[model samples]
Target chain A: MNRKELIGQIREKKSFLCVGLDTDIQKIPAFLLNEEDPVFEFNKQIIDATREFAVAYKINTAFYESRGIEGWKSLIKTWEYLPKDCFSIADAKRGDIGNTSEMYAKAFFNIESSGMSFDSVTVAPYMGADSVKPFLKFPEKWAIILALTSNEGSKDFQYLSSDGNMLFESVLQKSGEWGSKENIMFVVGATRGEDFLTIRKHVPDHFLLVPGVGAQGGSLDEVCRYGMNKECGLLVNSSRAIIYASSGTDFAEAAAAGAQAVQQEMEKWVREL
Target chain B: MNRKELIGQIREKKSFLCVGLDTDIQKIPAFLLNEEDPVFEFNKQIIDATREFAVAYKINTAFYESRGIEGWKSLIKTWEYLPKDCFSIADAKRGDIGNTSEMYAKAFFNIESSGMSFDSVTVAPYMGADSVKPFLKFPEKWAIILALTSNEGSKDFQYLSSDGNMLFESVLQKSGEWGSKENIMFVVGATRGEDFLTIRKHVPDHFLLVPGVGAQGGSLDEVCRYGMNKECGLLVNSSRAIIYASSGTDFAEAAAAGAQAVQQEMEKWVREL
Candidate 1:
């Protein structure tokens, strides 16, 4: 779950891709609803279909959140079905007051606490150190802070000049000190590939959870070109582009094919690493 | 649900307090566990109990997300249960790439798209303008960006120098331009009460969703001193200190009492406005 172990998995699989399990009920084929928990069934099938090709599973809490209680149970069941070697992320962008954040950390990282422990959770750094540090208090549990997101809005403030440097650069420098490279990561959206070089100049060694690939139209070659590190530190996520490849009975197969294509592409990158 | 109407609700309530519905399962009274969906039931009772006294409800998505599907349903149901006059918020700190963010916007603001529509969502402005603009696509919905938080690490990066301006200051000034005051709000932690004065200098007219007032020890008087505008452009939230006021069967009564106390203090400030 730590950086070294995470990197090792990519090296072993020859794939650095983290398939985002942003399973939307509406998006998944209607057939799965026949199962007790449609979301869990869909996730289990996806994990079974793609585990061999993926190094990590990033679950976006929003997709399940839109569903409510049953959705949460499905999320838990999906986590249960995921293999241990593949890193698990809550993909829950959470940050709050220190005391409250401690509870959130307990929920996502502590097996004794929530029963569903994720290796990492995406944290909003806007609340500052206390909000992010609570997640870091537990060693080996990574805090993926939002830096230069690929979204167009990233240009709104991330590039604003304080004097000479941009705002994101300041976030990169200051948040970097809150934890070690082993525990801290940045969410550098894949669309903003060019900024990856600049981002690396700030935190050269930490992992970057590069989202916005595939369905979001971010270029894989460009991201790897500007974002990759010596350790192959990048978890490029593709959700909609892969998971919902088909809406019929062959959906799982289609998903597998989609994952295979990305894995094949990543295999090339891994060998180069 | 939009800013104008939300302002009207605040004026009607003679209070600008938006009690945070961070309904942590363990924190709720054990009696609620007997219900089919304990979190939902707890939120329903709390909403019903506090509806007449408050103008807005800020549901921290983390509490529901940690629980998974069922939690999400609870959040949605809670949203539906709130009085129409009260503004409903998905306190989900979401920001992603352009296309991905478009989906998030659909999930939160657009009823047909997200299934459950919330009036506003809390967003982390780390990614800049594009990440935030996607949220603003909905005419009446809002994008509440993080400005100054109350956490310890707030100093770590939020105040870090970027060129000559503080990073948070740059975020406030730069991000404030992306949308009009109607749709763009800022999250200024109540724990940083006096600092709100400085933040307001940058975002004077926009609304603010202030946390840290109750359980986090943020003083209402201090926040009102430097933060409140003529329109009472503030929705101070109190989560744990109110919702978890007691764990016994008297939980709902306790929550109402807790909410009333904050509302009373908030009313004092509103009278001046």
Candidate 2:
């Protein structure tokens, strides 16, 4: 999806929520185990329940990858079942050398080869510019570069001072030259609080996919206050807090309630804008 | 495999050469396309032909992942077919948050879960300590962190000056505290010329996986002269120069010759050690 279309969905839905489908087989309802493809079945129901509130779906590739071939099958089937109106993200933090990275671009952005083309893929910035520019080559596909992540480890390297700016600040500043706002975005953790203000100074127009809103204790209000742009350019992702709200028979209904509550909160923020 | 076992393999084989299985479908012999799984069939042939001289095999996951589910199947089969005497490295270049990195570790380390147990997996160091420590939780497994890469983009962020040291140097210093030399290795590209001498100052004991030898124009002689330690702690990788040496029916034989030539040069270095 293009930036304009994504912004349109945010306005239409009154939410910039991107539901993360980091679905683990062990966490799902026990009854679903009898199904032929339990992971896909769980994702299908979750997508259906949260489609009304979500502007995108971010599938964490690790959950699917740990299961081997069956997990990969589940990933493909889940990708197929995702709502076309919502942007699909392969939260596969992938990046390599120039030629190798081109293969990764085909894996996520070229559906004909990989059988699933996500609108975007999360890329690690450690390998630098050439490693990331490969994904931007694909038309309408976004490259979400890691910047100031929400994890405790973010302090280890990301916060290092470099040439009058922190490592992540340099990442944002340098990566901005690779692609336009339409094809480039930053993964800024909501837990970073005031760091969002710092991130905005670098790429104010680019979309920021903010994780750690609910389960990780990041406040949506604070993120919106500092991170949101005129285009509602903040994709607040809530994974476990919404999807695993209930693991019993009422899981789907409970997931919907959780999503709706966040959407309703997001509606207030959108209204203010 | 543990560090001792890996060193043993290097000494026993009289070589520290790592054959990179970057098996691209388009580059393989056309005749293999008629097989049940052409990628796997091609890899099986390459592994069988090169197992004698190579001390390790690094599977670049991007090549297989580009093909989706079928590609994943090939990855598992390739892992299964790897010689027990040789070390297995998953050149996945994966890293995430604490919980997410655990999943990636399981995806590469836990054979019971992912049907693939590699000795080590390449991890991007942008996210820092916690993002990398999870991979070390598994006994006998290693986390190969990206230090100074070979690509031109390596200069973008890795060479950034911070507190009298470069970004890559800081990475070598700070990450040195996370894991022991027994469990942690760094990727110091052969293309970086004299940077290997600087890297050895921070990590004198830990192994180094060097890429960009043949196809990327890095010299093996220059790398060995500056990078080799007391135990000959280096796994020099050559992917395209070995795997795609020929596109005809003689592809596997050509690959064997390519691997043998590199192995012979590495044997000279090992003997000097």
Candidate 3:
């Protein structure tokens, strides 16, 4: 799916919240431990319950990855179960050499090999174009590169003066040339708060995947304030704050409620594109 | 272990080849494929076979992660099995919020719930200091941040103009201030070859985890020429070229041969340091 369709879903649902499935095994309801595929069961229930309030589902591969083969299968099964209209993300943070990346692209997007496919995948741009180009090669597939993240360490090197410019700013301006706004995006953490304004100056149209809301305390209002564009280009993610909302048997319902709250707030903040 | 200790091991072994344990399920021999934990068994065999020859083992979380819970367990077992003197890299590429990062550090280095304890981990600096700092907070544990990658799409923004500095150059200089040379390291792709000289100018004292040799065609002569430091601060990583050296039952032995070939070349190169 492309950027337009992503935004269209938000408009259709009047919500912009992207449910981040950063599921932790130990935190899931104790009941699931007895199930054959506990991870898949947890994801299935959460996805089923939260599908209504979210426009996107961002799966952090680490949580599933920490599990291994069974985790990979869970990821595949979960992807298969997600609604077709909702944008799917493989938050794998994959970026390697060109050839390896090509295979990664094939692994995630090639539906023939695995029935699971993600519309976008988070990529680390430290490898430069060759690393990122492989992901963007698919006509409609999107690559959300890391930009000015909202972490304190972002101040360490991203903002460091290299030659004369900061690294994150350089990433924003240079990476912008590889693809149009419709195909590329940036991961701008909401926790950093004000960095969004400067980020907007670099790529005014591309969507920004903003995480760090809820538990991390990144204000949703501030993220939308400086980051939003005429395209309504922002996908604010909340993970632990949603998925683990409640650890009881009603975990799925509680997650849906947490997701609903974010959607309600997003409905008021979304720009009229 | 800190940079000095890792360097000592490299010198004692007279090798810089850090064989990467990036085991994919499909890549393992057919016999082990039916095991209770194919990934862990494959890793055990490889580690046992290569432990004498390799200076370190970098466990790229992606291959294990593509699996989920089973993968996490395998990661724990691999870390446990790894020799203490040998540098154990989580290769998780994790960088998140301060609190979350602290949790990650605990998961990898602290022997609490996660029986895994790795010496180092790869982190994406896009989130800045808070994301990177939490990892650094652990006394001897280190953070291997991305500096210059060898991927195709990296040109997208990594080299873009921010005044005159390239994005990666800026990150290197900035992130250096976060931790002492004793703890911080950079991931400079070997494919960049001579660009190592350029990276060295920015981080002359810190260790570098260089990936992309062998299958990626990154030459040992070229990378060592520009990458080697006075302290011999270079942990050259070879994944596919070494781990997947053969598809047959003799894969582990073939992998040892591939690793030995690179180590022989690396031995010659280390003379300059």
Native-referenced TM-scores of chain A, all candidate models: 0.97, 0.99, 0.96
Please write out the lDDT profile of model 1 over residues B34-53, one tens digit for every residue: 99999889888888888777
Question: lDDT winner among the candidates?
Answer: 2
The residue pairs found clashing in candidate 2 are none
Q: Score the docking of each candidate (DockQ).
A: 0.43, 0.86, 0.29
Task: Write one digit per residue (lDDT tens) for candidate 3, span A184-217.
Answer: 9899878766788888888888899988888768
Instruction: Classify candidate 3 by CAPRI docking class.
Output: acceptable
Report the Cα lDDT for candidate 2: 0.92
Tens-place lDDT digits, model 3, residues B1-273: 877788888888888778898777877888897888888889888888788778889987656544444555676788888988799888766766665566567667766545667888888766677777878888888998887765555555566545556667877877866887888988887777767777888888888888877766687878887888777888889888878888889988998888788878888766666
lDDT of 1 by residue, A1-273 (tens): 878788899999999878899887777898787888888888888889999989999998667645545566676778788899998888877787676687678768866545588889988766677788889988778888887776656666667666566767777887866887988888887876678889999998988998889877799999888989889979989888888899999988988999999989888888988
CA displacement after TM-score superposition, residue A12 of candidate 2 (Å): 0.4
**Using DockQ as the measure, what is the rank order of every candidate, best first?**
2, 1, 3
Best first by TM-score, ranked = 2, 1, 3
Better of 1 and 2 by DockQ: 2
Q: Relative to the unseen true structure, what is the C-alpha lDDT of residue B44 in candidate 2, on a scale of 0 to 100?
A: 95
Kindly list the per-residue Cα lDDT of model 2 for residues A142-217, writing each as its tens digit: 9999988998888888988976899999999999779989998989999867998999988889999999999988
